[model samples]
Target chain A: MARPSDTKTRIQAVARELFMEQGVQNTSLKQISDRLGITKPALYYHFESREALVRSILQPLLDDLDTFTATLAPGDARRLLEDCFELMWRHREVLVMLLHDPGTMLGLDLVERVWEWRKRLTALLLGPSPSAAARIHATVAIGGMSDCVVEHASLPFEEVRAAAVAAALAALQS
Target chain B: MARPSDTKTRIQAVARELFMEQGVQNTSLKQISDRLGITKPALYYHFESREALVRSILQPLLDDLDTFTATLAPGDARRLLEDCFELMWRHREVLVMLLHDPGTMLGLDLVERVWEWRKRLTALLLGPSPSAAARIHATVAIGGMSDCVVEHASLPFEEVRAAAVAAALAALQS
Candidate 1:
């Protein structure tokens, strides 16, 4: 039998897996509970709604971005940008979720968080006196790196990762 | 009085504007008709449903990608890619519409056309025997360009276009 903490983690994991496979709208608490061999009541003990479940699922991802961003020194621009790309590549599922489900209120809130992260990233990438074009370039480059892995769905995972990193680094240089 | 064709064109233009401004889900055919100073029946003469109106708006954009892709010669790989970016930049609003409200059946159909265009483009960018990693890089670089322009609401139009073009060209080269 799973411990209380273990059960809570399992629900999140199952919820995320279902969300990814079937989309956020289609996945219900009952479905998640069914998949986990837990009662629907058991699932609700951890999350009252799918929105709460999504937020819980994404909290760690947001925290990771925060932690990574906070660790960068002011002038460590290149590494900071690279780290951002690395984090995005590593957390491709979170991004896929963002792209596929940007319409929901939850999705919009997540997008706002993403936007804030991008602004901080842009400041870090272009230390001072970024022209309108340079700033746009930095933002697009970072944005591209975050979402590129999903489109390369046919390629082997490692190949996709390597290519994404290289292209992201190149975008940084330009 | 506008000619019949001119009236049709005006409705489309206004609908596209409203879609961009208010989003597809929020905009209604009645609103579109009223904004164009036409009766509901008149709007229906040109478009039977909101879905039809959206398709009419998107068809030209899809046709543009078709026309653009058809012009690419084997030796003009780089030019072809740049032209594609320019087309996307030029039709930024339509691209944003597709990105934001990727609706039900018809929306997916239009998106599939764009995907096909991208596949054709992927073929052109990478000559025979390009590595899997190269293909992924190409997808990131190219896909990122358009995706960035649409998502980065803060970036100015020309800067986004220029950065997308430059980043794509650099990725193609490297």
Candidate 2:
């Protein structure tokens, strides 16, 4: 006897568990509903499609990213990289789900959103009248931080997060 | 009038041009043939599908990657980074085509190959008894270099290359 308000959260949880287990590409909405003991229609009522479901699942991370980018100010590269890495590390599961089947990511509109977000982050990191090479360094710094956590998920969080931030700062300095 | 052997090369070149000028997703095989003033069947004789055509166009880059990775030796990070940066620079067009329509990159089998290649490279870069943080640093170092050139293509080759190599060395030292 689940309440209506909690049903959406429940669905998001089950969908992520299933996506992580069998991969995003292989898991169907029907499978998710079946596991939750709800009808497929019930699932569709909450999420129109897999894209919508993935988006809803990742909305919090996107919101955090949007919030950080909105409040972004000129700062030392290390401080900025630390905040960005923490934001992503907080959403580690989303990155894990994506690492399982990355192709599924491109299908979601979030890719475009993240790309735009990266551009904004890049611009912020670029600072005043930066050289062309400096811009590349800043972009590389940003892109690499997000990627390392996913690629080395088996690594200790504290260890990898620090490493990613260090690497980003290194790129930014270059 | 291309010779039968060179038709493949010509198709690959025109396909890349159309893919770059338009986009990999938007440009059709017919458009490539239309631009080349050749019949669809004639084009088909060279490439059965857009996937095959993209593979053909990027084969040289992939082959170079394979060659370098195959002959990978235990070397200083700067030397390894320089070789990798140069290889990517030489195949700049392929990266440009991909950056234009990144979503299309997932549709090709090359994505899987590239992922696997990344794993192999990460392993090679991870020196003996590496810490989890060290592993993350190495992988970040490797990924950032490839992405920087593509993301900041307008940057001078010498400058970006130097920055990327320097950034990579900084990461490796971490």
Best by DockQ: 1
CAPRI class of candidate 2: acceptable
* Global fold similarity of model 1 (TM-score): 0.77
TM-score to true structure, per model: 0.77, 0.74
RMSD of every candidate to native, in Å, equals 4.5, 4.9
Tens-digit lDDT track for model 1 on B1-174? 545578888998998888776556657888988998878889877778767777778777777877876775665655765677678777888877656555522434665767778777778778767887777677667777777667654667666677767776666555
> Tens-digit lDDT track for model 2 on B62-147?
78777776787777668777887888888878876664545555555667766666666666667657777787787778778877
Candidate 1 structure quality by residue, lDDT tens digits, A5-105? 78888888888787666456546788999999988888677778667787887776788877775675665655675677678766778666655545543
Model 1 residue A29 CA deviation (Å) reads 7.6
Clashes of each: 0, 0
Q: What is the lDDT of residue A127 in candidate 2?
A: 62
Residue pairs with colliding backbones in model 1 are none
